[model samples]
Target: MSVRIDITGLTAERIHFAPSPLAEMGAALHALAEPAHHPGVQGWTTSVSACLDPCLADRMCEADFLWRTTFSDVFTPSAGLPGLHTLPGATLGEELDLLDKLSDEQFVDAALEFTCQSEYARRDVARLDDPRARERALELAAARGSHQVRFTQRLLEDPPAIRAWFRELMQDCDEAFFSDVWGRVRHQLVADARLKTDLLRRKGVADALSAVSGSVSLDDSGRSVVVDKISVGHTETGSGSLVLIPTSLGRPHLWVLHRKDWQPLITYPISSPGLTAPTSVEQLTLRMSALAHPVRMRLCRHLARGSYTTGELADAHGMTAPEISRHLSVLKKAGLITTRRHGRYAQHQLDLSVVSRLGGDFIEGVLR
Candidate 1:
């Protein structure tokens, strides 16, 4: 119910096999599936671009593109992953050309193929309630050394209560986020384009959006499934193209639905095995948190040099005794710095050993 999916025994390639002649389009699906090919997966979408603040989508696009590009560069394909080399159709170049020149009809075919496969593929990504699935998928995608696996395995073993402490924004996000109605709103827009429908009269999207025109079919369980027949309009005129934009919304896509019928001209698949870098998430969450403030980071820096007592630290930081105490209290809560009372003035220190590990991870995140 919480968007959790098992993904226990899943492999990334299984997604392309079903719902399409992926073996024939095998070249196509595999080309599309990888992180390298489209580093823009989470940033391109047609839905919210139509409604949300225009600048909002663009700004979001810049930010997500930055992260995804950075993340994609480091995502080494799993060595044993099935589709790494089983490319069929045209070379990736050909497929990319096809992607750019893809018609409304073609887009429908691919999307239906993708969705059908995703129906099964999602079973793996979504069914996972365990965050370890995320951790493992990340390890599988970003496998570097045994230490990563061992470390992640150990962290995964920790209970969820502690895990949940790490939040995305360090603050609460409301429903306007891509999770609730807006998510569906964008989804409907893309689905409309993908399904290429004007009315849910045929499909079940209700009186939602409409589609362009053209027809597309994919091999569904060895059978051809007519995904759509719709015509689509391009937002970027004279260019004959659709642009995909990914969003921060937890939902998996940002897309461009052909206005003619509603076929998705462009879709950015934001969800993936390594998409949830648990360690990075943890580090980012902790670091981004304004626990003690800039002054606190300075304090932490000083403490890392060596520990000091409350009075000495307060005088050094040029803060009053109570003010410094408050800062130390916040740092303690953040698990960054700790203090122990000695005589009248409590000794405050960087909590070196623990902070060192945190610093190591912080460096790792930056490296990643």
Candidate 2:
């Protein structure tokens, strides 16, 4: 299953490429929370962990819900989250200032949306429209985990207090380590945004969507964007726009935020020296070398038509299964193909986006 974005009538103006400090901050926090998920930044993570204040680290650990689930919806482009909804601030401090100025009414509505984790709870909260309903929602959320009980309670009783509390946590996080990390990666993020924007302007919507992430693909009709995600859902950007927010911290994870009366926002990873530059000189060489083989080139051409299993590819190429598997492994290592399981069989398909970016990557790598 995949998340399909229906872009049947979206114009170039309706598609936006926003480089956001707020998004990067959120991504950095997520990486901090789950360092194991981002293996490439282990060195940076180690240094930052050493620099992090003990109390700040403890507080972040306590707010596991914020990073683990939908509780951080306040930071997303939800109609309830005012001043921060799809607004790409120039700096994290600017975003924090907007968060600091959040009105009581706005905080209550946004916190309410986040606190009600389930549709049934949200419906009851809306239907009842009472303090008790809000309390019930908090209790349900608290019952799910002990970590966020006090925070959700504060959300129910004193919205401003909870807001201030999280604001302080965010501030401490910024002061402790994220600011340094942001300074290091900000330029690369902007460059990636500029690259995608250029692709959008020059190549139109299909290529533009393809440039978002390796997992994102535009269907043949050019009306739908197929995103490879664990959770299966369909979102249609009817009159709303599609907002692309680039982050340098959260590699290999694409986060989507869609809410009523707000544009659909996707926070995708674009780490420096990877998306913005070559991972290594060896990567360019590997990609070139993988396709240089005549058999592998023909294999890629066959897979371009459709996906195939090892035996099927062997049969088509008149090679043994072992030989074809070896060839496929080289292509896979170079990020030229993706393998997916179909029942008991593993089927491989060409990753067109990665292949398409090779020429540009080569040019940038060579010039640099």
Candidate 3:
């Protein structure tokens, strides 16, 4: 499933880049909720989580029912938020104030809209008033579990309580750990946004979008930005603008929020800061060293045609099984080969993409 945004009438002026502290807070909460999705930040997540109040952590766990695909959409400053003008990017206080100001009815409506969108791809305002639609949405929410269904029911039944609960969660989160997390990552986020702006100026929107993530690309018409997502929908950017946000905590996932009547937004992963010339050179050197051995080079040539077991490779290369195993371990660690087990046999094969990228990777490293 994917979301296609038509950029036919959009321009450089229509595109903006910024970092949102509220958004980062939501992402941090999400990482705490689903640690498996963010293996890169496990240490950070654990350290921060350990510092939280036990009661507050329990409250956060209770709130996980709202995380259908990610941190609850209701908690995020989506495009539909009444006055979430992210052009300048709001401070955490500013965004929380915006949330605090939403009237009971408005907050309820937003919660319902997010609920409907999580189950169905569309977020029709009319669905809020449709009793049948609400029931059906609740029914689909059941697939996630009774806990989520009950959570949505409570949200619909007691908007004021849910709103207050959500608000307190954010406030406590800021006090507990997210404030410091933001302080630590704010500079990196700003640097990424600036880098994106420069890329947009030099290469145009498509390339800039590509820089955001490999999952973003243009359709054949060159008028739409296709984002790979689990839910499918289409949005036309008639006169609406687009906002691109950079986040250090939102690693390994790209999130897109689109609405027919508001500006669309995308939160993409921050590029690795460790992608320095030294690191690149080290990787190239490692892969080269792995293949530098005569036996290893011969193994690569043989594996290129097809996979072979350790015993087969040893016999073919006039070596012992242990010798072939040691050489395979080196190739595997360098990411030049892959091993898969089939019953009692483990087959080794060359990874063609890594092999083919060797020259380009070396040149890119040197230039960097």
Candidate 4:
């Protein structure tokens, strides 16, 4: 199961892996499989299905080149963080020269607006399964005049309600829901992979910065990651114009451009550039580290969708109540997530900011 293949369009009847050369050429990939990095081993199986069996070796070579030219260039210097590979620290304090380059007119509508709308779209999706979420989505849709389909608006307005409806529709949705959602996102990701621009147009970075702006000052851990603000403005045609390049502290070579031929404004997170980019590095690290614990990690992963109580977490993760409580205590302490008192039950929900940070990094790391 480590490898998957679908060579339907290719002339090859079967694909074979050159064990020695392939393994030797892919040490970085193997390194990525280390438990300390990405937990799911399947995430590291960099497989490619080619049409011609004869070209399998060549394809593997190409895959190796891609892995090197991409992941290694970004991830290595970040020092084993699974998310965004840390950019070079040496380039710190570099003046945000891109702002100077931009003539006054080029900077129009704030990039924050688009990033906010996009982030809202994502958050809006999460509530799709919940009835309450659906209602909220509809309200927002009405307010914003998104005019998405009424049903779509409903789904968007009340995610919790919609999610509950979806569960009822699908019946026994937990198992199938993840697969379906993953398929949706992965399919879109794979399809987008065909174009080079898809890698750079990472909508998540802007979203992360939007969330970060909520913070007044980031802690020491947050300081390690630099996020420079990009001056965004509206164009005469009524579209967003990003005057600066958006970047991650861990990534190099990959800078956020305007998705067009605009000037590339390279910037850093000297102090969280904006609200989307939270000064919660300490919270992030602490939360991730707390989740790193096998029991809690499994619990969090298992509960990615539905709400779960302490008992469910304990039962699912194979830990005692006391131990689970300890982990939960750490998680809440780190502000990675929170617990709500629901009558006799206490439910845990992952903080959206933390989720955005991790998600933003994951998107940046993989897409880049």
Candidate 5:
């Protein structure tokens, strides 16, 4: 469930963080499909919902075929961003023009490859023939639902329509949702890139990447970087560089895409108030402030035992519920804890991975 990237020959200069409108569009679509995964982007989601054509919004929210993992690659091709090292300077019209140029054969081939990667699709499409694959594709499609099955069948029968549908979705999102969202977050995205650059200048590539998330870390041998929550694993022995893209859109999780013909890319969430670790000095200072208090330290230790409600923590600490609530809020803001509502009561639990890393990082910073 992790990707072990072998960065043996990669230099700090080779690692780049750039913004991508195509990547942002893909992230926005993902957020729309699984709103629960991105609680921090509720405001953007609401704005997107309001801007989208009612039918399109409903399809984005309620349709399974539209949100399928295969469709992400299908919709957002690498051609949109011809240069991997910088924010794609291409206009939306240019990007869409590139998408429109894709041949029907390319669409069909990519779709088949994507479908084969799916667990359900692989089982159904036992043979490689188009007729058999098409027949079985319907069975695979039916797994998502009957409505989607027909749509999938049509796409399989007429590959050109797949391109048309993808273009339509992108056009809708580019005009309706992505333009506004990107305008609002572009500054933060640039700031995040600057912070990473500063970390590279002050610390090193290893420390800069480690600071990104608890889920990303250097191995004991120091030859590999392991990214958690990814099912696929591969070693890059080629001479290609690694691209690191920081985006406000891809919050709450990191996305990795590897291709032999292109630089391996990692799109991670930039630091934000309610999302993940703070990468810059100001943000880090605020996070470190949470641990500066003794009462909060005691509360963190207590929560480490197990999840507890505000009243339960108050009773254990001999404090009022409001006092415990304030302490919990600080811990939550520091990314050291998470709270979930269970009926009328809320349960709080320590994020042990982050807490342990913070302790180790503090010690290392002091010793150095």
Candidate 6:
């Protein structure tokens, strides 16, 4: 549930915050595919999805590579824009140039490795040797109708065709969606990068990282940083500098990339006031609806004390677990509470800041 980054002997200079235009574009495509996960970009998601070719959009949505692992080196910090300060100033032409220069081998290798990194692929071919496992991985990938399956297979069979398809996909996204979306979000990305840079300058690393998100924190050992993610946890030990990228496109979650060769990169949501502000009128209606019930209010009050499992709350209230789970879901979607899994059960806790903000916003609106 968390990725622990071991930076035991690293200095402050080792941590760098860089924004990427292409990376944001990749994130935007991700949001487009999974719009429900990114409430902040719902409007853009709809707009961009409408712009994309139906077949292409479907393929993008079906791409397990994009959704599953950050193991894809093609989206790494060094892959797109060159320098740390280059992203804010990068143009679409630059992204295209970088994409054009990407070797066919890098794309094929990343795609295949992505398949191998998946839980299903790992499980399917666990006992098999390398060659057989890779073949089985491809079979499983193709059976799932994965977006990159055809491209990956073609790379081994007809390399030129795979390269052409990859280029075409990149060009299609860049021309149809990325260019305009990047233009719209570029200033915000730049502002976020500058803000983080200023924080690093004034407050040092720990305070700066803490400011980004509550889920990001320095570990108890003070020798590493822990990122609260919902994926398989791993410990990476190396002497590489850490790159912290603030992305406007990837919200509500942190994307960590830790490969053998590349610098450890953590792309987290940008802490912009407006970006993290309370929900819109429609969203407020949903939150208000979720809070209107007596049982849910009591649940919130109970969680205010500390985190509680659904079973515990159900037992305390003499209600069924299913009923409690439904209530918890409502509260969670309303941003009133957060749930983290521990073993087999999920612990739900009230988000005090969100509750306070909701109250303040309600009071101000009523007064107005």
Name the top lDDT candidate: 3
TM-score of 3: 0.69
Residue 222 in model 6: lDDT: 77
Structural similarity to truth (TM-score) of each candidate = 0.28, 0.67, 0.69, 0.27, 0.63, 0.65
Poorly placed runs, candidate 2 (over 4 Å): 69-71, 77-86, 100-116, 119-124, 271-368
* Per-residue lDDT over 1-368 for candidate 3, one digit per residue giving the tens place of the 0 to 100 score: 56788889788877878888877887888788777677789998888778889999878776665552464444444454454343533677777666656565555555555544554335454434778766876886687677668777887667777877787887888988988888899998888888889989999888898888766777778899987654566776666667888888776667776644545778877888653222234457779899889989999999999999999999999999999999999999888998899999999999997898787665433322
Query: What are the per-residue Cα lDDT tens digits for candidate 1 across 1-368?
Result: 01111122222222121011111122112222233343333243333334555544443332232133222110111111222222122222233332333333223222222212222112233212545444444455234345434433433343232123212211111122333433334453344333332233344221211122111222233221222211122221121211222222222222223332221222223333443322333434555473437888887777888778777777898899888888777777666776677677677777766655665444433422
301 Cα displacement, candidate 3 (Å): 13
Q: What is candidate 3's CA lDDT for residue 301?
A: 95
**Residue by residue across 247-272, what tens digits does model 4's lDDT show?**
22212122222212232122222222
For model 2, name the residue pairs that clash: none
**Tens-place lDDT digits, model 2, residues 1-368:** 55677778878887888787766777777767767666778788788878777878889877655664432545652323433234556877677666666556445555555545454112333412476766676677776577567666666677777777878887788888878888898888888888998999999877876777666678899888777654555667777678788877666667665544445677777745434423344677789999999999999998888889999999988999999999999999998999999899999999998888888666543422
Scored by TM-score, the top model is 3
Q: For residues 1-368, what per-residue lDDT tens digits would candidate 6 score against the true structure? A: 55677878777766777777666766776676667666767987887667678887765655536544332445553532333222322664455455555454444444565654454112233212356655765776685575556655555565456555655676677777787777777788778767877888898778877877766778777787877554444444355567777778776657676544445677777765664542444455567899899999999889999999988999999999999999999998888898899999889999988887786555322311
Tell me model 1's lDDT, rounded to 2 decimals.
0.34
User: What is the overall TM-score of model 2 with all chains considered together?
Assistant: 0.67
Q: Regarding lDDT, does 1 or 5 come out ahead? A: 5
Worst 10 residues of 3 by lDDT: 274-283
**Steric clash pairs (candidate 5):** none
Model 4 misplaced regions, further than 4 Å = 1-275, 351-353, 362-368
lDDT winner between 3 and 4, please give it. Answer: 3
